[model samples]
Target chain A: MTERIVVSPGDLLGDGVFETLHLRPSGPWLLEEHLARLVRSSSILEMPEPPVDRIRSAISDLSVSSGALRVIYTRSGVLNVSVSTIPATVLRERREGVRVLTADLGFTVRKPPPWSLSAAKSLSYASNFAARRWAARQGADDVVWLSTEGYVLEAPTASVVWLDGGVLCTVPPEEAGILPGITAEHLLSLAGPAGLGAAQRMITGAELSRAGAIWLTSSLRGLAEVVELDGVARDRSPWTPRLLDLLGF
Target chain B: MTERIVVSPGDLLGDGVFETLHLRPSGPWLLEEHLARLVRSSSILEMPEPPVDRIRSAISDLSVSSGALRVIYTRSGVLNVSVSTIPATVLRERREGVRVLTADLGFTVRKPPPWSLSAAKSLSYASNFAARRWAARQGADDVVWLSTEGYVLEAPTASVVWLDGGVLCTVPPEEAGILPGITAEHLLSLAGPAGLGAAQRMITGAELSRAGAIWLTSSLRGLAEVVELDGVARDRSPWTPRLLDLLGF
Candidate 1:
């Protein structure tokens, strides 16, 4: 059943922050990290700290074995928690990989605005959705946004991770001025046990294209390998399943 | 009484478009223009055409003589019309003038992304709100964004207009890729009758400071003269009230 919430018209203005989590039979994966990011996002928006305990209670009340769980907190102090079945497209992207396109975002990371919410997982996601739609129109499954300087920033909804030699690398969130990816960071944390070096580096889109393998990482999709970029197809990387298993997907 | 709308969680993602109008005793001011822009904005977001007849009926049903009227349409096809008391701050700004700050938006208008919604008044207004908060922190009433190239763009919630000798000017919406301001456009259309020539020109932040007068124009605010720019005070221009009246504020 679709869940609905009563909200003031002001609450619909995208003046809020949100977190999406992968709900598993075990529990919501990376709950602490997602919650912490939610607080950080709210601070960036100058909103009051979210009620974490209430969010936890709302999550606890859900009886679904596994699904997608979302927690939203608006500037007007409206908090909503809802659970829905994961979309089949997300699962398909995880298993079959995604064809990706690269586009200049026409913005620089060097000097972001003082009130920049780039680091926040704010609810103003229209542009993100539009960019993905643009990708679909271009016959690709996703897009990686590059700063005007040609540096790879991230995908609209995911973090860009690439294998460079024996190292696994992703953009440093602080340096890129983007939302920190919980899933990508967690995967990097476990890289050592998987016999790969993990690092955060600013790589240009051209440089990214030449990497051994590339993937877009997020909560629901886990990680979708980039099988094609800018119309060029790439061979499947041997580490896809290994890393997926390493992250317990 | 506070108005409430029942919405699904997805409706809050700022994946929507909206227009604000000055409600008047005569009727909702500039109703047709606003509804037309709403359609254009929805097209930009790739949403289906808004139910114009429904919105018209909603506006006609409002009995409030005067207030701020907002029409919102989400990607999920939710249409909402709400009327609320105009904030005292808005009235104060219109009458007392506003101190403005100019800040680099860290983006170029030269080539906005293909999926750019910069020209649309999308519901994703977190950054716009944040910019104003940043201005307040700087002891200013509002802010005007500058493209990375230093060209003045628009205020967070309004358009920048200025007087250059006997001519009135504003940034061309198409060239600057910012949301076109209905209030500013209407005022410009009547400029000839007000004994002023009007033109849309790209002006830099530095150059704008030398203009005879400047104001931020929006639907509800009408026109708020810039009392100060970047902490430098300017003498009140006699055109402030004249332009406000010309726009039928």
Candidate 2:
């Protein structure tokens, strides 16, 4: 990335909202939903609602760049658009299943702040990045944070999706105080009609481990299965390719 | 404040440490301690140890500007320096006291992650700035955060300092898992020989209200008395200015 973007000093304080979309050769996937969530996230920070039309125009003006399109909206009334090659590690994790760790998130979901942006993609992501970094230092690929009361939350960069007896389950973000994963939510919506059961439940990490299969879902990589969770090797499920194909990964 | 201070795109992320010192006409006050703490804070973030000789030369090259001197160190090995005037509200609060609100910080300080940057002057300060913004919405000058167990931790931008029975007390940073307040530590030390006692104690918001006097200490303002906390009036103690004088505020 070039250091050519001139932003106000306040932008560096992380008082903003952002969206990281899987930029394809044609266009950004799930563009509308990402834009909607960006506005919602900005509102939680008490920022003015961004101009969606201008954003769409900017998207239409783009060329054939299959990379990440990051839209950062700051409190200083700045909108930044930067592109870079899709992170190599994300691709590596997608090819080879990731090793994972788990820890308590230490926050209640029900009593989240009135202006909570948990369901929105916000820019205050240092803690999330730090968690992943911590996991890497511990020889794991990522971490799944549970609530202080032992309920599963989400991962550093992806949503938790696991197979609990034939039912594809993910925690209800509204009840879990987690960012609603667009890809995972879209996948779950399709599961029911495809002769597969879908459900949202408050689960414990141990309960997750007991499941037949577990996967981390996100936009870029689609779904990266947990090959070895905390050094305990697990067999990869045959559902991986099917789910990725359904999501057009 | 100059646009020429070119920074990498990654610098926009708040993975860094920072220090703001009171630049006097004489020199940078408490320069050595500030520099040491900056290094300590960087280590917590796993950043490289800054070159002390380079920093010392930077200070020597600075003009005699009596304002706030800020040093920012990022994990990506970037160090930046800038000078800016303190906000008018800071001086206003110092002279006329301030109204502060109490709120849950939503983090268990006691069990913070081993690599947590709680004691560091980090740049991932969106939450800190957000807390102060929350206070503004609640008609107060600032906020005092409490741990999940209701123990008073520290303010978003300053440290909590209270006088109980002529004894000055501030939270123990290591025990409380919060940042060590340099200004508060300095004042507490100066209070001892000035016929006042000093100590570190674990306190709660309710426990804090019963104190003889309350103050929020920082580098620039020195110390701002809390005449009203959560809307209740507090006694105006004469020790405020005396304590300030001892610290050359």
Candidate 3:
């Protein structure tokens, strides 16, 4: 499907917005939430918000019950939607969990530049992809980024979340100055009813490793439980499947 | 021409490389120099060097002169060369001059990140363009960026050069960890024979503003003389046109 979208040669500069959804037999899961984020993302880049109707029209077809869904919006004024095979790495992580490492990203902690689209899911995702590739090369399944100040940030392609005793937690977007993770937000919203509490707070990487059960959450992967952090291995927590079912995965 | 390319939609993500040459009646001015920069840029993004012959074939009916020539290369595997009308403001600056402001960009003096592409002219150019847009929004013609330690860095899209008495000087790319400015390098090379000394040294913005004449140099604009530093107006120097002509603008 990535090859199917016809576009201009200039569209590949990574100056675009994109959303990845987990396609379920029911439909593109969390479709509205993802679409809303796309619109918000576009606005941050000073791009015109894409009409939601057009997005709906593009993905209205009935087909694959399960796959990875992607919507890309470019500064050159192109919006495209597509579906493809779900990555095997995502499936493996969902099942067996993952080993993770942490590193400082060293970005400006002050106000982002006037044109900063840090909150946008822009297609300029080469660095994100490269970070993941670097993690793979280092024998870790994923990486959790830190600010130069040593405050924990998000994962390259997912949000960092943890079960701090009974309180489920994720970082605050405004304070962290990161793209708000839709899947993590949805999960946090559901925490209260799941007999747990949820909070948004900044934590250091060391604090994260000591949490009850750490996971990287995203639309496609849903949740990849961390079985080993840094180097110490741990047994899988029993809550992984329960949370997936709650999310209707 | 933007509409003519047979590109897949994924091409728009800002994850690419580009070369902007000063197009002249004699074909692209400094074509070899620009191609070498393109190759250096490709290595920064971990992409394969594109086939130069393919790029050469695209420049067939080379009929245009005195324009801005840009060649875009995307990780999605598309090589696009385009020639367009240069911005009138650029020409105006060549004829007149520019009011310049300096600000600290907060980049550390330490080595760039392992994955940093700061030295490359990769297509993740939204920030570079945004900085210029920011300057325009602030009512200045352009901005000269400074490092976190207050060392004078390059401009958003050009190299910063100043005349200290009879010596012509600019920041050394290797020492400053910046994208080497092709125009500035060429100008500095000819400075000695022209009876002006040439040097590369790290200087503060205050030191630059105190210099006799200040200018921003790039391939397209050649040299944009600084008519004002900060809020203080300065007279246009006689060397602006001489240097532009020397570079064959």
Question: Pick by lDDT: which candidate is best?
Answer: 1
Put down candidate 3 lDDT per residue, A84-192, tens digits, no spaces: 8888988888888889988766565564455566677877766776677777878999888877667777898999889899999998987888889999999999998
- Candidate 2 residue-pair clash tally: 0
Residues A107-195, model 1: lDDT tens digits: 99889998999999999999999999999999999999999899899999999999999999999999999889999999999899999
Per-candidate interface DockQ score: 0.94, 0.44, 0.49
Ranking by DockQ: 1, 3, 2
Query: For residues A1-249, could you state the per-residue lDDT of candidate 2 as single tens digits?
Result: 363556644566666777888888768988888898888777767778987888887777766467888777777776666667888888887778789988766666546644355666666666777788899999999999977677889997899999987899999988888888887888899897666899998898889889888999888978899998878999988888888888777
- Report the number of the highest-TM-score candidate: 1
| Of 2 and 3, the candidate ranking higher by TM-score | 2
Per model, the share of native interface contacts recovered reads 0.94, 0.27, 0.42
Instruction: Please write out the lDDT profile of model 3 over residues B1-249, one tens digit for every residue.
Output: 444566665566667788888888788877888888998988877888866777777765555665888888887688787788898999998778888888766455554445667788877765666667777777888888877677887887899988999999999887777898988988999997788999998999888878889999998889999998777899778888778778876
Q: Residue-wise lDDT of candidate 2 within B1-249, one digit each (tens)?
A: 542345555666677778888888888888888899898888777778877787777778886567888887777776666667878998898888889988886678657764467888887777777778888888899888887888999998899999989799999999998888999988888876888899999998899999999999998888899989999988898988887787687
Local accuracy of candidate 1 as per-residue lDDT tens digits, B31-128: 89999999999999999988999999999888787999999999998889999999998999999999999999999999899999999989999999
Model 1 ranges off by over 4 Å = none
Q: What clash pairs does model 1 have?
A: none
DockQ of candidate 2? Answer: 0.44
